[model samples]
Target: MAFFGFKDFDRLSEVDLNIYRFFTANVDKVPYLRVRDIAREAHVSNSSVMRFIHKLGYDSFPEFKVSFRAEQQQAHPTNHQINFVTDQNFPTDIYEKIELVADRMQQADQVIFCAMGSSGALAEYAARQAAAVGFNAICVKDPFYPLVNQLKNTSDNLLIALSVSGKTIELLELLNNFINNEDVTLVAITAEPSSQVALMSRYVLGYSVPQQRIAKYYDLTTQVPALYLTEQLISTARRLAVQAGDHLI
Candidate 1:
């Protein structure tokens, strides 16, 4: 409820933040509501609403609403719009790939998540979910966080790699270290399934989210697609764990 008002969330003042809270709370109605309606609901002047839109770089309320609706399309696309792809060499469909990763987790003694930059958050989230479902979870956010021990873990491991571009040099190098290990099963969730990350993975779940960046370093692409896919995988794995009589924490 607190982080969805504008892309420049950090630059907002306390009053603007309050307006943002109102927007997040009533997201479905904001785009359709008139400026006066928003002002009344949010307990602010109409000028405040105008200022909020202007601060976000929109010329007018209509322009802002149009962009907001388009953003909504990307964030909450319909189920029929959900699509995942993988390399042609391994064509087992998306649902089957979920089952495949779940099967690997069933046998894996360790579940390590490897990612960096903006993607590091997804890695941590997926790792916590993995541990919640009972696998010993390890998160490697730093690219150089002692790879020798993580390359293979107790003869059985599953590494879930996340990236938007799938071309991160340090991350790819880390994955390459585990690519040849027979006991390690690598799974990649990326925008580009054909990239080297997917090529090295034992299974790949690809989504077609548009890549976005800021000034130079920040990747602004929506992680909604990847987030949904990872949650699905963890949920499926949790189901498998329950069916097998494992006590989940």
Candidate 2:
């Protein structure tokens, strides 16, 4: 409730606004982040982050976070409502898609996790978890330069693209690069099954969350579904590998 108020943030500079947006979008993770971490994620200077905190009438980042967490803790218990993607009754096809994605992940030689913005952070985390279970995985935040350079010659790779809308331009362009490549498989964890990314993906694990929009741009769509999908894929793949006598550890 405290973080959602925009009166003060609306009066700030553009850089501060971007920082506010990032903080708001990722408010759930703020309790674990430092001032420098927020600055880096918001693409701003540490001084700017301090100034932004001061603008909210906090003398220091720790004090500000204490209040932020207090406010969240106060509201979170009541806010633990049903999640459409995780708690609601989904159709049979939803589970089927997850199984198919798990099958593809188990068979792939390597895994590439792709996303943009906050989702890229998630992709990196999923990649790390997959690698821990012995799957060769890497996170590609940008599909342009570094990713293209690293994965140019690789084939038999599984791409797990996470986008709530499934319409990110850069991600789609990257997916299209291997649209006809039989050696690469695309698995989409998205909110919209009809989105370009989902349509092009070989398997789609979609969620049923109400798309949140501000000024005709999607802003607040939760990614719990993507996280769920990644965890499921990792667990399913791990179990299958063990059953097949493939030493995952």
Candidate 3:
């Protein structure tokens, strides 16, 4: 939701003000910071840090961090966004998972992307990316009902559902209805591994990152990870296709 940005800044005490200033100046370091770390950096006690977060109207440290990160995302979105691709465990964890799905992708007759909102836009872009690599891929943006109907009769198709939260009701509803089909494979690309869309899908490619809605308007995550996965999948699938003696295009 929307919070009064600078208006709330004036309500803090001197100690809290110092901590706030440290946080603002070092906003880039906020993601890796702990409560004790903040206290140490601001030269304040742990209790003071806790109180500062409370003064900001947050109930917990993690909640405050989420909002703070979202704010930073909105303000400094250019080259400062978290790099999910080069992260330590990302290559090890995510690449292995991508390999598991690459074969299915190569074998699939059609690729269908389903999503709404910003995710829908990503799905369209992903479809074009796949098509550029010589795969038959399509995206369904809205009026998802027609897509749902079409999915019922489709077989040997890969459905990639793109949603950061994986909690979109329409997307979940579609998954619930289509999960029983053996010939139609379901894949969920989401940030939350435990989300409904992940559980319902046959396979999941999860991006574990801090996803938040900034000021109730900006979605501060999803696109980067989704695009990363799309590029990797297309590359891997292309490689595998060449290995199998099948020329794409």
> For each candidate, what is the lDDT?
0.82, 0.81, 0.81
Tens digits of per-residue lDDT for model 1, 1-249: 112444776777777877888988887888899999999988889999888778878888888888887787678875673334234323348778888888787777888888989899999998988887687887899988886674534678888999989999999988888878887889999889999999999889887766889897889988877887788888888888888888875
Candidate 3: stretches off by over 4 Å: 1-84, 88-91, 215-218
List residue ranges in candidate 1 displaced over 4 A: 1-92, 150-153
Residue-level lDDT of model 3, residues 209-246, one tens digit each, is: 66779897677774777788878887898788888888
Candidate 3 clashing pairs? none
Give the per-residue Cα lDDT of candidate 2 at 37: 92
User: Candidate 1: minimum summed lDDT over ten consecutive residues — where?
Assistant: 81-90
lDDT of 2: 0.81
Quote the lDDT for 75 in model 2: 66
lDDT of 2 by residue, 1-249 (tens): 255554855569998888888887887998789988999999999999998888877888888898888887776756465644544534457766777777778878999999986688889999999999999998989767465556678778898899988888889888887788787888888888899999998888877777787776536767677787789889998887888788898
Give residue 142's error in model 1 in angstroms: 0.5
lDDT of 1: 0.82
lDDT of 2 at 84: 42
Backbone N/Cα/C clashes per model: 0, 0, 0
